[model samples]
Structures are given as structure tokens and as C-alpha cells.
Target: MRSGPTAEPHGDTAEGDTAGRAGALRPRRRLLVLASTFPARPDDGVPAFVLDLARHEAEEFDTVVLTPRVPGAAADEVVDGVRVVRYPYFPRRFEDLADGAILDNLRARRSRVLQVPALLAAQYLAVRRAVRTGGPDVVHAHWTVPQALVATLAAPRVPMVVTTHGGDVYALRAAPLVQLKRWVLRRAAHVTTVNGEMRERLTAWGVPESGTSVVPMGVEPGPAAAARARTARVPGRIVAVGRLVEKKGFAVLLDALRRIDDVPWEVVVVGDGPLRAGLGRRAAGLPVTFAGQLGKDEVLDALASATVVAMPSVPASNGDQEGLPVTLLEAAAVGAAVVASDLPGIRDVVHHDVSGLLVPPGDVDALAAALRRALTDRDGRERWQAGAGRAAEPYTGDRIGARYRAVLRAAAGQHPD
Candidate 1:
């Protein structure tokens, strides 16, 4: 497909001036991104990895994001230098599919599954319009199932790259969904998974190893100010950052907190989800603080002041688990001592007894012991804090962005300038 004129509206210019500038400057290639979850506003704390990647890509390409609109979010707006278009899939009140967790929502109320058809249809139409009007050189789809399927149907001529962020490949294992995922993977120019284990999983699902790459979701390395803040960490303070979901293992963390009641420590839980009420009730009489859903800066502050960061993630009953938790990387970046579950992605980040401590998933006794050790041992905590910065260096935005840019350029058959 031939690249068309840019869809971006220009400020009024003299007729000759417009033509002169147009001829003088080479236009940036258009990149259309398909993502399910995106921040509706600047300060919105929705998973910002997609938004972060889009912003970095915007530096090289004219990036435009097409995502599903939620209840209170703006339908279309430019955020952080990237143009975002949110499409209405259902009635505003009923547009809950993309709100918190799609699978969790569907599992909680079976009626939410009815929104799937409209969600897919609206996304497909919006993507088709973007391809026809904006003439993207490449389409980068964030999920394997619905977003990639929508891209395949809507912009078949456009070169596409599909990236799976764990849940799509792991949890959605029904025969039909698996077949649909395989179909999308087969058609894409390239595919990416957040971790090596996920790449292996995709290979088993019929995707060729040569076409897939492991590109973990990246984070902005903590700033110098945040690093300075980490120097004065509050003693005996443990911080856990993630959605209050089953897979996050917040309930298990609460049990561990209860086990270590004699220790002079406080727990801060950052994030909100369906399990908030139940988890809060369970943490009753404990020194747990629920700082629900803060902005990125606030999260960084929490990490900076944290003596230890706990990520007690476990596999959920529905086979849902983390690909890699960005908060762990962020905490490490801030020089916080981390104690995480010994799972695939978490293990990849936290080297046992090196950068951070690792405990067996769902083992309250082991988790409590790890927390006690991190909180009480000064020299060991110092070693973990020092090594965390080195461990987090690979996940910085600059390194990850370069990798993604290279892949996107290769898929589009463009030589780097």
C-alpha cells in the first residue's frame, strides 16, 4: 500500500509557503497503534506502558493510538505528544470492558461478555478508518486476540506487528480463542512478548520463533530526585504496588503481614481493583495502609520511601498471571529492596539473594520470613538496594524504545536513517 498524505491538520499557512515547507521537509512515517488499555488523561493511572511506548515512538513516527473509550474518559485527545482516539464500543455506562481488567470484568458478570462483539466491531471500524485516512506505514497492535484480529480485518494491507503482554496468551486458552490467536500470529509481519517465557509459549502456539522477539514493557528510569529520596527510606516500611486482584496475591500478602505482627513495620498497598473491599476487610487490625490508585509520581514517592517492596504474585485460578510487573522494575529503579514471588517474569527481574529476595508463591510463612529479613537486616538490604539499580538498567525506556523502533522499522521495510 502506498503511503498517503498525513491526516494531521496543519495551521493556516500561505499557499506557496505550505507547498515550500512540504517539499523541504521529509514527512515522518505514520504508525497506528492498537491498544486495549490507555490513559484517558495525563494523570490517569491506567497501565501507562502502551502510552509510554507510543510517546517514545512519537519521537520517530507520527504515532496515533486507537483505544476503547471508558465511561468518564474523553473520546479523542492528544496526550503526552501522542494522538489518542478512543472509540465508543457500547453505551457510555456499559463501556466497562476496558475499565479495570477485561477478563476479571467478564468473569464477575457474564453479561459483560455481550460487550465483546461491539468492542471488536467498533475497534475494527476505527482501525479501518485510520488506515484509509491516515495511511500508516505500520500498525502496532498491543494484544494478540481482539486488537490483532481487529487490525487484521481492518488494515490487512498495512504491515502489522502484534505484541502479547501475557494475559492474552496465557489465560484465553479456549479452543476458539486459541485458534483465533494462532490465525492473527500467522498473519502478522512480526510478534513480541514481554518476557522470554511468553515468547516460548507463543512458539508452542504455532508462531515461528524467527518472527517473534522478547521486548519487555519499559519504564522511565527513576529521576535523580527520586534516587535522592531513596536515601532516606522510612525504616521498616514495606510497599506493595499492583491492582488488588487475585493474581496480585494481595490477600496472601495480608496473611504474611499478619504473621509478622510483632515486627515494628507498616504496609502500604498502592492500587485499586475488584478485590479492594474484601482485601481491606481481611487486613483489618493490621498496620496496612490502603493508598488506592495514586498517580505515577506518587507511586515513585512511595517506592522512594519504601524500606522493602513486596510483590507476592501468584497464578490465579483462571490461569491469569503477570507477564512482568512494571512496578518491580520501577521500585528497583528507585533503589528499593524488593521481595517478590519466584515466578517466571518476577524471577527474571529479581535475582534470588542478589538484587532482591524471592519467596515461593502463596507461601505465607516464607513471605513473612523474607519480609522480616529485609526489614531487619541492614547490610543485606543495602546490598540489594545497590544491586537493584544495575538490575533495572536494562529496562530503561531508552534501551527498550531502541529495540522496539528497530523491530517496527524492520517490519515496515525501512532502513534506519
Candidate 2:
């Protein structure tokens, strides 16, 4: 947690730094963040980072968020002290379409050929409007396409930073529409990834190493786990949080649960996604309870009430993975024991047998055995809970907010007036 060299605003040192690197800038700055999918209609967790940024950034910078409205979602206003402007977007019905069949499928593969132009125009228009209204000093866009393209096109004179989350970096690069995303990245003043793995991936894909920053999504202080520790019986309740996707390794967790027939456990998975029904079928006859999706408070409540939080995350067959599930950090913050897969981003957050237990990726028996051990060993659980809670201290939203502030300062320095 050593803070990097203190940002030096102005002069040659500021010429190529991220806005967050410019500490000596004018006291207050205006920032506009463009995200493809932000929290909309209260159930969305996609823009959780934006919400955290706005909350903490408001202390110093004037902030506004421009997010696309998924067809049926409500148009926006301010939520939790952040100014949210949702723009019109086409309904995406085939997001879950399987790879097969028809001329429509072929058209859909080339669909981005059409979708990209429309998205760029809409996002550029929205950014232009925000500039007129707020006179933002920098434009920060999340995800590769549209945000990067729109920000570049609409606010070329304004310094801009683009962040590449999992999808854009891992899935979209080689896609048919990748050239546009590549163009957008090339034009961005700075590019960031949530973890080191992504930074390396993007660099390999041709983004300059100097322009990339690794800034993970931060965790918030959750309910204390010690309060729950007072109770004697544990391993009775288990919790899992994340969208119900193949990459999350939900099926593997189910397989683990089936192997441990003697352990009396009840699982509460707290998120929704396309695989819900498929997972529901796979979980048949197990002591599982799918909570569908829950609010942040609700998910934390589940973690606070649980004995062990299992995060059996694994890199998907197609190479998709997590950038450190904030859920694990939240569980640790609340004093719950963590048992997760040892994978790229996860390895950065979880030290096997130190902060939490780490099992091999996709090993159901290992996951189940770890869970059983964590449940029965009160002393071991207490040790991990205390140590893990302390380990999570640096990841809290407040701490992360401060880190992002530093990054923005650096990014702004790259293009000082």
C-alpha cells in the first residue's frame, strides 16, 4: 500500500501523467465519466464503481455520469448524490444468443458493424451536452467501445481516460468490431484496467505500457464478522455473490456440495444472470437457496450472517475471468472466512491460508473440503476472519476513492493547459 511518488503538477513531469497524477492542479476540477452500463433502475450493479467514484469524488470535483439506458430501463436523474443521465439505446435481445444457425445470426455477428456507429453518435452527443453544461476538465470513459470512441470524438480537446473492464479486454479485442475499439484506445490519453492481468493483456494487444494503469474496484466497510462469530454453530450458512455465469463456477460449487453429503449446509447465491435457470436445474436436490439478486445492503447482510463465503471463481473456457470479485473483499471486511479459487486477479487479493483459503481453480472436491474445514474449525475460522478482515482494510471504498483521486490527478497532468 505504499503510495506511489507524490504527483507533481505542471512542468515536464505533468506532461504524460494521468489526471490522478496531477496533485498540484487547481483545487477543484470538473470530471465527467462515461460508462456503457451503469446502475439503472436500482437493481443494476454494473455501475457500482461509478457510484463509489461519484460519492468520494464529490468531496473535491464536480462529477457527472453518462450511462446508456438498456431499452426498458427508466430514464435517469440523480441517485445517491450523483448526477446520472441515461441516454436512449437500442434494445439488445440477442445478447444471449448461442453461436449457430441462420442469416440473422450472420447479420448479428456483423451487427456491431451497425451498432457501433449508432452508439458512438449517441454517446458523443451526450458527452457534448455534458461539456456544455458542466465544462468538465476531463472525460473518463469505462469499457472500450462507445465510451472511448465517443469521448475521443466528442471531447478531443479535453483530456480523456478510458478504462477496460473484463469483457472489452478479454472478449472483444479479436471480435469483428475490434478495429474500432483499437482505434479508440489509441486515441485515449490514458487507459486503465482493474487488475494487473488485464494490464498485461491490453499491453500485449498493442496498447502502450506507459498509458496503462492498474486500479481495482474498491470494497466498502461491511458489517463486522465478529458480531456473527459470537454464535457457536457455523458452516450452517454459506453465501456466494456474483452474476450467475459459467465463469463464476457455480456448477462447480454445486458439484462440491454434492460430494460433501454429510455436511449440513444451506447456500444463498445473491445475483441473477442468464444461467439462473440452468444453474437452478443443476442445483436440484442440494441444500441451496438462490436469492436471485440482492441490493448491496442485502448481499452484505447475507455475508455478515454466513459462516463461510465461497468464491469458486475460475477462468472460463473462453478465457474470461474476474478482476478480483469485490464480493470476496466485502466478505473479508465483515469478518467472514473466505474460500476461493487461486486464479490471476484472485491471487492478488487472497493469500492461501493467510487472508483466506485458496483452492485450485475448478476443483470441486478441494472447494468442498475447504468449506467443510472452515465450517468445523472454530479456531481456524476465527484466525482467518480476523486476519482477512484486517487484510481487507486497504480495499474499502473510502481507501479506493482516495486511490482513484490520485489516479485522476495523474491523468489530468498528462494534458495540463
Best by lDDT: 1
**Model 1 segments beyond 4 Å from truth?**
1-26, 222-231
Tens digit of per-residue lDDT, candidate 2, span 283-304: 9988799997776666677887
lDDT of each: 0.83, 0.70
lDDT of 1 at 74: 76
Q: Let me know the TM-score candidate 2 reaches against the reference structure.
A: 0.81
Q: Please provide, for model 1 over 1-417, each residue's C-alpha lDDT reduced to its tens digit, 9 standing for 90 to 100.
A: 233343232223232234334424556677899998777666567778899888777655678999998766777778876888888889887679888678877877799999999999999889888888889999999988689988999899999999888789889888888888999898999999888898898889889999998998887874624654655688889999998888999999999888886679999999998898899899899889999998887788888889999999999988889898888888888888999999888888799888999999999999999999999999999899888877888998867876776688678776533
Residue 49 shift from truth in candidate 2, angstroms:
2.4
TM-scores of the candidates in the order shown: 0.92, 0.81
lDDT measured at residue 271 in model 1 versus the true structure, 0 to 100: 95
lDDT at position 378, candidate 1: 91
